[model samples]
Target chain A: MESFTIVSGTAAAIPLPNIDTDVIMPKQFLKGIDRSGLGEGAFHDLRFDAGGRERPDFILNRPGWRDAAFLVVGPNFGCGSSREHAVWGLKQRGVRALLGTSFAGIFFDNCARNGLLALTLDPATADALMEVAAGPEPARLTVDLTGCSIATADGRRWSFTIDAGRREALLHGRDHIATTLTRTGAIADFEAGHRMRTPWLP
Target chain B: MPSPEPLFPHAPDRQGPRTLYDKLLDAHTVCSLDGEERLLYVDLHVMNEYTSPQAFTGLREAGRRPWRPSAQLAVVDHVNPTAPQRTEDVADESAAGQIRYLRRNCADFGIELIDLMDPRQGIEHVVVPDLGLAQPGMTILCGDSHTTTYGAFGALGYGIGTSEVEHVLATQTVVHRRLAPMRVILDGIAGDGVGAKDLIMAVIASLGADGAAGHAVEFAGAAIRALGMEGRMTVCNMAVECGARVALIAPDAITADYVRSRPRAPSGADWERATALWARFHSDEDAHFLREVRFDAAAVRPLVTWGTSPDQAVAVDGTVPDPGTEIDPTRRRAMVRALEYMGLAPGTPVRDIAIDHAFIGSCTNARIEDLRAVAGVAKGRRVAPGVRGMIVPGSGAVRRQAEAEGIDRVLIAAGFEWRQPGCSMCLAMNDDVLPDGARCASSTNRNFEGRQGRGARTHLMSPALVAASAIAGRLCDPRDLP
Candidate 1:
């Protein structure tokens, strides 16, 4: 896990609503046994044409936004699948944060667990950020988890909210699996008692 | 952060009426980590090849094995070819690699796996519940979103990402957040030709795609009670489309009967004990629901998705919506793009839209009952020329049951192809794929753009409607037939 405190980078905007996980990481890239080199597969259809060539009109294909670290997106982004591959692909493609009005529940949770910041902002603020990112020159924004704020080069800033538990986990690169394994005794005790109460359970 | 001193061996007695979800959470809580999160125990952790590989790789990298391997069930469904011939061959090297990796990982970890060659192998959502692995008063987790289907049996089941999957594999527990409760009461009986698929589609369309977000939905009332176990599963399975993580129906005689006949179900005194516990699994009379919505089941008609999203659906007799009618600029723009992608005109009637393919399969509607319903529609009717109809059962058991009832013969005799089981053409991960720009009347869930294949158009409908559309070469309502 990578720790997150603050990151400043150019942002890209895809303003269409309901950009689901299928549109992010398509099904064709899910066959690999390991997670690596998925940056190419992130938004495969939108990034490429039928001939497998890059579509120049796509936001991520443009020169200033090709390697964007932040995404200013529309509401309900990452809606459909429970695939962690979608988050992994985004992170692999140099995406450090996503600014949206709202996100799908499971995908939002997936982003938090995988060290990607999914920020929920007011609709007006999100629209403003999208406009800023869509400009001719790349828009560089700074997201600071410690400050709970996002700011632009012009000194404009907006505050956001994140749950305390998740905030602490992200501040330090916490390994949830390692953290949970320390309570093995408690888990075993619960299982033993659970068996007695409902013995028929598998 | 709080210390781990509050860990208790048994569930604490609490006052007040509790929903089924609350009871399940209380019983499974290892400890409360925070105000919103708890270390909850998992009774069964189901897995599929597509999502389990990365988790296994993480486990191997960390030198960890599943704490309770016996409590896990792995199956190979996605990315497996669904050809009629029973061969273990997968031509796609990458997909074949995933299955091989899954088999090796399951064997090495001492976990039970229904491999591709096994007669019990099928979609995880269908195979697990059919084998009685998903029982009432239990907590189940899986890598696929449709794991909500197990909630039909009164289990608290939901989907998780690969990171959570690895955590569950390592600890047999997940750091879970409590969900707000929403109850949907369906009143009145469904009219003729309206089934569970139509009922759920109507709910999704009425509530919008994100209506149930951040909530655990409980389907209740007279209409839901009147439905059979198969119908309950259908309703719960599609609950995810409305953004619900968990969907539940309280256990009753219908659930008990379905579980009693399963191969792994308890018998004798154990069965009695299980049923007694299951009977007490319903929400209390005074249980508090954060939100409630009531619908008249009789008013629901056969629905077909007119646009890219499932909520963009309308009644079969309805016409496509014009984007000009939408006041919100963003929503109107989305509607216009969806109409473009679906190749539908705003004023065109849903029944007038022609389809090139008709698919009947997916975790949502490929059960024996669904197959039987489609068989009834295709029994004596021939598929319209130029419409390719295919039926892929949810699992090997469903395929065998359909064959025993001669459903395969009827469908095949009507110019339909009876294919082997797997998630064939639903997500198009396997050899079964719709051609680019092809429109399909499908029984599967998710009408997102390119769900069946790249640039493919899907109009989500029931098995009967799909069958009817195949016979008519368009999106025809089942009631319009005969």
Candidate 2:
């Protein structure tokens, strides 16, 4: 796993609530197990017309936010399903952190496990950020995971938080399995005690 | 931090010093009776095209055929390709190979296989229940996590890893640790537009994703009983979202009726015996659960996730909670990260956001009923300009039936692509995907990042809500459409 921090180059605004997994990565891409190349197919139906051409009217096709790294979205960002591929897709596409009002429980856990930061803020702050980023030139947002803060280029900063255990794991580039392995000694000690107390079975 | 006390304080003391899960294990006898070993006596095993090829290989390598072929069923659904017909144009070689392997294995073992060309072929979850292969009071295992969808029939349905799949194929049994029971009782009637999906979303939001880990959930009470089979399936399908081992609803008349019409369901006298057995599978009137939670069905509304996690959810009308107020600093950071990724401000009205795409499909909500609901909303309405939307039927049968009923026409007239049957756009499994940075309103389960594709943002909602969003090109309540 790659451990790194990200700064939003230009804020891409998607002011939509309850964006589900199917719309983010449609079921069609699930045919493959390989994690790469999915970013290009990210929003197949939305970005392209029936003829498989890019829909110029789509927000993703717009020139201003084409290279945007920060996404300002509506409430309930990852709402449907528990597919972990959603996180892999986002991470591969250079989405280091997500800013939303709320998220689905499983989706949030998946993000934390994959070292992706999913940030929650009050609606007023989200709206302000989205408005600024939706402007012509694309506003820059900074996300410092070590600092646990997000800020705009103008120095407007907002504090964020993460689960203490998860924060430690993410900062160290360790996943749950790694954390579990750290307790091997303790587990071994417990197993030895159990064996001593009950020796009837092999 | 110390693990919280076992949610069920009295469970260990109940039933003569053994919990229900313990009893189940002992009965299976795959392990020692003293709780030192594991045992399994699975009643049903389901396989899909994506994960069964390796399992068949394992079986072949072991020089053992399926021990109980009668208990096994296979289907080709996941990689059927969303083209106009079920053809060989599948984009993934592994998916195609898996399908071919499933066909070969089923033919060799005499296990039922629903081929993609077969009208009966659909998503494993949808096909199993629709064909009545899942019955009440049985233990069912599938290679897919969404197997919990069969719990609506009162069966203990859950997913297993690939190794477990091989074990089940060769021995017709799986070693499993029983789970404590959690009861989620619904009281009162569901309000209009509130369906099983909303109920499950509300429960997950309240319990958090890991709340029911190591537990088997029993959905009960008036509102639950009132749900149709399809609705109940939707509720049970997402049980894993809360980390529950499974979710089961007691077999009832509705379940029996749904099964009665299925081709594989027991017939005549056998049916009567099966029904009697199913009726006995309910928890005893005095049976105790490890944890009990009650919800007033009327309190649930069309809910959606605002962040990346299922637990970080709110009602459509609710605003985002400020992370600073979270009691746990660690959780506060998680909330903040979710917000940044989702790009929402706390206290902002969730309904005000605009949507770029809308999708309605997946095992969680792609049943015929779900299609009908979306068709009802799409009828006579055009998709909002610049909004991309698609309706993928769950199965070939559902697709044909919808066409017969003119539901497809309604969807087509609304400018939504009426795709062929399969798990289309629900996951980035096939060619379906959202462009990078595109946000969408979807009806499938799971909103994990890029579940659709890399850099794709997903918002979970009911099918009607998805349709409404498609029509409005943003998040809008279905009730407001008319």
Candidate 3:
């Protein structure tokens, strides 16, 4: 995980809504959990045809979008399954940020946990960003987490919202477990009392 | 898409009055951070192959063992080939590797591994609780979102990501954040043909897919209390489908009875002590819900989903919705897209739609009670021509129990394939899958696009609904059948 303050990259768009995690990375590709080498499996069906050939029409396969640093997707993005392989795939594929109207809460958390930024914007603003992505040349937008704003190549800027805790976590590249460990004493105290009341629980 | 309904509509918002979730979370809290998040102590951790391999590997990299091997359980499901005859022949080499990895890793770590052929092996969600590993007033974590399934026993369980998985494996605890509690009260008695599936589907229909996001819903009232343990499990299983991470039903006699016979359950004096503690697990009378929604169980009918989202459902006899009637533009577009994907015409009776496959199994609705419902409908009937029907049990134990009760014979005689239990065709991770353009009536929880197979369509319904529809080779209401 890298401390994310401001990131600049060309954006690609997968305009389909309700893009579930299964679609992002199918169950077949989830066989291993190491998180490496999963980019090949991201969007497996949509990215590949029955013959295992790349679909020329896929946004990721299209020229100019080959190295997408960010994704401009539709609403309810990453909607199904708690599979974090979706995040691993996107991160491994070099996607640093996800710009969407909204996201499945679990998917959003998974992104933040892995040092990938997930920012929510109103559809209209996302539409503005998509326009920049679809412009004559591939567009690169500079997203500043500290400033909570996205600046397009065309000089237009749209603000976004992120909680303070998440912004700090992303900026510091903090693993959630480390933060949770700070309160181990409190956790132990509660567990000791809980064990007394229900002596049979393992 | 957050629903327009206010979450705190039940009463004026207040502070200091703890909810069921708050109480449970506070009880398990390690330390509160900024009053917004807290570290949580997880009692039970369950894992499946698809999402857990990375965490186990991470443990090996760090030279760490699971904090408490006795507290963690692993099961090989998801990609398991369900055909009892072909259990040894895994067609997909990669999926076979996944199952093998899970077995090898579980052994290396000293955790309980219920392997594919293990009679105890089944869907992790179903088998863990079935064995009484999930108990009341405990906080449970799993790599699968449907971990909320154990909330039926009054557990504070929810899904977790793989990173959280490695964290829990190393340190027995994870972080918890702000969560609001909502209660869905089922009032009045359900009419004939209406079951737990219908009740849950109706709730989703009322609250949209994201309606329960960021909240925990507690099912209560007479209708919920009246349901058997199996029915309660069915309702809680789909709680995640509505965007809820957690669902609960306070422990009662039914829950106690269900746990009593399981192999891991406490006995005699221990049981008495456990029951006494469970009785105190309810929310304080003064507790305030962030939201409260009520559904009259009597108004529910055998239900079916017609669109990609679970909320896109209606009564069995209802009609496909016209997108024009949806006031929200985004919702209207979603509806139009769903109708197009489903190849359904608006205003067409849902009962008239046809299905190519009828699948009866998933952790959601694959219990013995559900099998009995399928048997009840298929006893003297054959699957309609052109329709393929299959029933996969949730676990090998369930399959054996069904066979012992002769339930498998009734289904097999009625043209339904009877097979060992695993999550078959639910997410289509194995050999049993629908082809592109095929339409299926399923007893699974999700109906998201491409959920069953690439370009395949899924319609969510109860096991009984799936059985009746299979007999008719299309979507037909059981009430309309003999």
Alpha carbon lDDT at B167, candidate 1 = 92
Q: Choose the strongest candidate by TM-score.
A: 1
Q: Candidate 2: misplaced stretches above 4 Å?
A: A1-202, B1-37
Candidate 2 structure quality by residue, lDDT tens digits, B1-482: 99953322223433534333343333333322224223355667888766566567756765768766877888877666786655656566767766777788899889988787787777888878777777775678887778888788877777764445766776655545457778999999999998888999999899876667667888998999998999999999987777677788888899999989677788877777678656656676667788999999998998988876766778777787798788864467667867876777888887787888899898988888999999888989999998988888887777888889999888999999888777767766766778767888999877765667656778888898899989988787888876
What overall lDDT, based on C-alpha atoms, would model 3 receive against the true structure? Answer: 0.84
The sequence of per-residue lDDT tens digits that candidate 3 reaches over residues B162-199 is: 88998899889876776778999999999888899999
lDDT of 1 by residue, A59-124 (tens): 999999998999999878888889999999999999999999888888998999889999889878
Model 3 segments more than 4 A misplaced: A48-62, A122-137, A179-190, B1-17, B86-89
DockQ, 0 to 1 scale, candidate 2: 0.07
DockQ for each candidate? Answer: 0.80, 0.07, 0.57
Candidate 3, residue B145: the lDDT equals 78
RMSD of candidates 1 onward, in order: 3.1, 11.6, 5.2
* Best candidate (score: lDDT): 1
Task: Answer with 1 or 2, whichever has the higher TM-score.
Answer: 1
